[model samples]
Target: MPRYRKRKQATQRKNLIGSLLIFAVLGLVAFLAFFRYELQNKQLAYDTETLCPSNITSPKYVALVFDKSDAYNKIQQQFLRRFFDDFKANLLPGTRISIYVIDAHNNKEIAPDFVVCVPRTGDDANALYENPKLIRQRWHERFEQPLDLAINGFMQPAQADFSPIMEVFQTISLSAFPLGSETVPKQIILISDMLQHTPEWSHYRGQMDFSKLQKTLYYQRINTDLQQAEVNILYVRREGMEKLQNKRHAFFWSDFIQSIGGRVTLIEKIDG
Candidate 1:
């Protein structure tokens, strides 16, 4: 009877050891599962769009502003407000917008918010341009897309005619539709004052060799499609920028716009 009891005791010890080992394994698996879940959530939260961070240390937001309001000698200031709000909305959410407003005629610098952030408030330095570097860095993971347009000279007949507007754009896209560089432009927006006139269509700036510009545009265009990148032209004059201004902006901009996959909207008259 004592021998039988010893055998039963040994069996119970073995059973207890097996049960404890099984529980330990189960506990370890649960902890590992929970830890993995937490890590995945952390990574996911950082990799997507969110509200704009008031500070630039965060990695996903970018803000760009071209304040043409220096020319707003008259129109209601609220128009400028609408223009900015519309611009902010057009950007992907959680984007930070840095603003730069240049005096329409004198080239005087107007610091909307970057008053203390820059060395001197003028075109002499890109401090105005530098303020947005943090945000631009966030786009480095994507391909670089170059965008060029006549930001200053789309009005004169010779200068405005067939502006090598696509040169910069192609420079960034030849290898990939989107070029991935920490500071390269992933998109392009042209904000223009819509008053354009071709004084005399006789001689052309074609006398000017934009081979460099044309080359920059052509090669990238070979690899990229005008359809893929989002191009927005914010015209200070919505009066008929993409429609009526075509006679000067391009040979037939209405058609070019269709071919290129873009839409034009008036950015409120700043020159009135």
Candidate 2:
């Protein structure tokens, strides 16, 4: 009887030890899971659609100014497609992209075709916690589709009697990148023939001159503060207009952009 009692007590001790070990392992796992959840929530605590904080304001701005004063040919269109693809790929998740069109007839009116902040995609999601497939689907339905539609509509041929590129710039600087706002990275993708034609001043009349433009009242009227925005000129080259769209013409525009507190990053000529 004594021996049997001793064996029973030993078995009970063993069971208690096993239970304690199991509880300890579970406690460790719970701690790790809670830590991971806290860290992820802090970093990715953003709205799914805007990919921005609760304020819904983006930290970066990208403005695309399309000059539809002249129609783009098939080859130029192809080039534009490739350029847009590259631009989309490099964009950060929360960047705001606004599309503006320089009207063909009405140089005074500058209207935005599309404006939206990029959403977080599948690639930006964590597979361990979030469903990437659902995020991607939502992004495509809400963000990508509308952007594609707006761009396609602008790609169609539209000819204008005048191209008021300077006025459009001034308006964009005032409306899009308003003064006193928090300084953020700003970029302008200008797709045009780099030709400035209006009732006041026309580049087609004679040789391109930067000094002559600075002396005019129109220059003062169009004086814009671009807020140190980076300008990428997608210069459209027209057939049989070499003299107007040559290297000197490009330099003239470059000087003008610099005077307005904008840095010219690229001046790529898009030709058929």
Candidate 3:
């Protein structure tokens, strides 16, 4: 009876040990799985071509058109710099920004000088899981620097006989925000003197008559579909053109933009 009791006691100890081992293994596996999931959640994934976040299904589109037909004064430059700073700050992650420069000499094809999507920055990072410094550094290198360089290069003054503001707007509409596609949110920031001068139509030709403008062949050629885009006109004041650039001029532009399916949200004048 004593030998049998000793064997039973030994068998009970082995079973206890086996159960503990199994529980420990399962706990370790659960811990590993949880750690891997946390790491994945903290990490950011971006597309190679668009630089947009992989998780983003719909991203906002911002198009900036800098009309460099005339030189900007010191005051105007300072305002523009500050405006750009704010613009950069307000941009959300995964938003695509395209910067286009319209020069004095009109090119047959208009393309964006800089195009990039805002990447995940330190603000979007988790401190416990990821290094914010590295993420911010990558954002600055990949997005901020190149954009600043492109903008600075285009900010230089250029003199031309004609400022094709209308043609450039049409081109931007067709290329950036095409018709029948309202899936993505669109915004256009136009920094210009608001002087529409082209061979077909010229704001310099006395007063702007919207009725007459509609009758011209130039008006007929406008197949621009802004697709309900939000237009922000940063009107740069031109020297000795007070008669041309007045309340009437502003109204004409607002009316024109509205006529083309665009909503003129802001028509702020950049005072020089």
lDDT of each: 0.36, 0.80, 0.81
Per-candidate RMSD vs. true structure?
A: 13.6, 4.0, 3.6
Residue 27 lDDT, candidate 3, scale 0-100 = 100
Q: Sorted by TM-score, highest first, which candidate order results?
A: 3, 2, 1
Q: How close is candidate 3 to the true structure, as a TM-score?
A: 0.83
Q: TM-scores of all models?
A: 0.35, 0.81, 0.83
- Name the weakest run of 10 consecutive residues (lDDT summed) in model 1: 142-151
In terms of lDDT, which candidate is strongest? Answer: 3
- Per-residue CA lDDT of model 1 for 180-234, tens digit only, reads 3334333334444423222211113331222332354443342333333344555
lDDT minimum window of 10 residues, candidate 2: 47-56
What does candidate 3's lDDT look like per residue over 1-272, in tens digits? 99999999999999999999999999999988988899986556877755766655536878899988898888988898889888988888878787777776666665666678887778867676688899899889988887887777777888888888877767777666544448788999999998888877788987487777877777878747788889999999888999999988988888888888789999998868
Query: Model 2 Cα displacement at 209 (Å)?
Result: 1.7
Stretches of candidate 2 off by over 4 Å are 1-57, 105-111, 178-182
